[model samples]
Target: MEPQKINKGDRNKIYFLVIVIAALIGTNAYLFFKDRQQSERFVTVSTEKDKLRLEVEKIEVELDKVNALNLDLNEKLVEEQKLARVKIEELKAALEKNQITQGELDKANTQINELKTFVKNYNDQIIQLQKDNIFLKNSRDSLQNTLRNISNKASNLENENANLNAKVKTAAALKLQSAEIIAFRTKSSGKKVEVTKSSTAEKLSVRFNVVPNQLAEKGHHNIYLRVFDPAGNLLADEGNHFEADGQDMQFSHSIFINYNNDDSTYVIDWANPKPFIKGIYTVILYADGNTMGKAQVELR
Candidate 1:
């Protein structure tokens, strides 16, 4: 058998076939590598986006905790809590897109971390403020309690003083039961004769019985007598004015009676320098600065 001779046309056809096969392989390899690179980049973006979303969720939770504080006492923190929630919403919005850049991710991560720090600091501040409030409240309560105690003590002292004053007044009071007044003229024979004619009357006698009281002190007490005539003038024989219980009053006469916490009788005499003429005469007896008894004597 004889070897066949190679032609240029056949050789060119073989070279062209080799070039077409090589182009098909190169195109298939480029498509495969490009698809794999796209898948890997998508996975990275998804992972970063998920991470940012989770961070946002974390921030939301922290915001809820911060907002849980007492609003009345911590009203100043309301704005801070709102701003944190706003930041969380921004993060959520940023992650909502199907695409994310490296710079956006970095920014989100940093902001999330900063927000966490802010939340911690704000929470600590709120707690400290609340503690201060408690301290102030307790201090106010203590002050109020002290004032109340002082007021109560002062009231008790006043009550005690009032009781003491009442006791002193009771112990110092004197009572008189029976009172008698007689108008008569003394005879020249050194004897006493009762007379009802005021034109000839020469003397006036006053008598009273001191009531017994165990509470009153035993002492020589001065008794003042006020005698009023028909002209409404006090029959003052010695002094016209007498002081009783810080009041200056005009009295007719006075006598010292020795009291021993028992019933005692006393008689006092008053002399008229002039002729007495009256329709009715009133006699008021004063003991311990108070009017104790009174009596009337009638004369024609």
Candidate 2:
């Protein structure tokens, strides 16, 4: 009935084991807290991608405003719009794969910067255009006043018409070299042959040429086509809408041309929703809000 006494070495070993266990537990707790902090601070891929997407949407909205103004008569703004859209697509693809990296984020930001710069430049140009227009208007008024004083009203009106015509001529950014539309039959064999009768018409092949114009701001151009039947029904395909002079309008089809201020050819095939009728078909071509040309065909 005597209490057992522990050896000194055994007591020291026991103390050492207790200290080791306590140290291990503290280290593990510290590591767990540190990892939790890092996880809380981590940004997700979707967040970054959403930020990029918002930037793209911003750029597109600005570009749309310019387009609605119908003052972006060149391809530069359109090209910027295209580039922004391309970046959005890339971001979407990366987000789908969950592989969006910091580098992709940086690239998307770069595109945003470029698009913003473009928007600023476009706004500046628009302001300058407005200033020029005001100057022109004031000059016309002064000239009219002088003409009235001198009884040269007829000459004053002629001068005004001339000025308007000059603006119109300069506004014709792209000139037409050639344009044609040929009706074709799409056979059951998936072969095509030129057809004359509307009954045999499967689709209309539209072709046109952009003549070189050094004055035209060169890049990518969106060319629109409006096909009208005898009853004036618009034949539409993709790119069936456009904004012209602050008015929304519908177009039949559209194609893009990279006009390096050089002659280039483009074509688009249109298959109307309804069969062709035996009547006159009119096709008009427009580029950057300016009508390049028009032609008509008699379908018998």
Best candidate according to TM-score:
1
Segments in model 2 whose C-alpha atoms lie over 4 Å from true places: 1-172, 237-239
Clashes of each: 0, 0
lDDT, each prediction: 0.82, 0.77
TM-score of each: 0.55, 0.42
RMSD to the hidden true structure, all candidates: 8.3, 34.6
Q: After superposing candidate 1, which stretches have Cα over 4 Å from the reference?
A: 1-8, 73-76, 172-300
Q: The CA-based lDDT of model 1 is what?
A: 0.82
The TM-score of predicted model 2 comes to 0.42
